[model samples]
Target: MATTNIWQQFKALIPEGVRVVATIAANNGNGTSQAELRDGSVITVKGETVNVGEKAFILDGEIKGTASSMAQYEVEV
Candidate 1:
């Protein structure tokens, strides 16, 4: 299947009000970071973090909260 189609299918599986934790894939160093969601969508988050691989709870293009590491955040999710 095509990648876009596959992503859509994965997104459909997520129920409403269920928040997904995304990892900070890349930080632009300009108050923005590229976050990779569970559905494979890259969201632009406005935040400042020296930790590149940190996990964060994002909603509507904003970082609501963050964790020390991905493993620690995954436990809460």
Candidate 2:
């Protein structure tokens, strides 16, 4: 069975421009392990699980995927 992280799945279900506080625990091999906000800053997530302390405001275009050719779609925070 494929196990995907809760943070990853939760982030994926949300639409753009929504304000969210999330903590990245594990990356699903897509390069990013944390939530990206509307801003232009890539925050590095650490640990196997995240809690209230690790929560952060979602930055714009911070979620980096495996698509190396999708650079044009990135938004500057």
Candidate 3:
């Protein structure tokens, strides 16, 4: 659980899994798929039915939902 405390009250921020955006590179066809992150790293995302080449929000190896397909720009600071 991701928690944050404000005024001595605890609140959960990211309920499950780390928030990450990845593109589905391959669908294993058994409810599991391989996703590629923005850094060109590949990871296996399980328990979500996803299509190839679709960007998705992954958490705890599960799909929270789809993400925007717009072009992404990173600023190096």
Best by TM-score: 3
Angstrom error at residue 14, model 1: 18
For candidate 3, write residues 1-77 as lDDT tens digits. 53355633433332544889899999887888899998999998885666788899898888778888999888999
Candidate 3, residue 1: the lDDT equals 56
Report how far off residue 22 is in candidate 3 (Å). Answer: 0.4
Model 2 Cα lDDT, one tens digit per residue, 11-75:
87888673444544445454446444336444554332333234444435243222221223656
List residue ranges in candidate 2 displaced over 4 A: 1-16, 27-31, 34-53, 60-77
Clashes of each: 0, 8, 1
Considering every candidate listed, which one attains the maximal lDDT? 3
Ranking by lDDT: 3, 1, 2
Q: Write out the backbone clash pairs for model 1.
A: none
What order do you get sorting by TM-score, best first? 3, 1, 2
Runs with alpha carbons beyond 4 Å of true place in candidate 1: 1-19, 68-77
Q: Counting only residues 3 or more apart in sequence or on different chains, how many pairs clash (N, Cα, C under 3 Å) in candidate 1?
A: 0
Q: What is the C-alpha lDDT of each candidate?
A: 0.73, 0.44, 0.81
RMSD of each candidate relative to the true structure = 10.9, 13.9, 4.4
Spell out the clash pairs found in candidate 2: 37-58, 37-59, 37-60, 38-59, 38-60, 39-60, 39-77, 40-77
Error of 3 at 66 (Å): 1.2
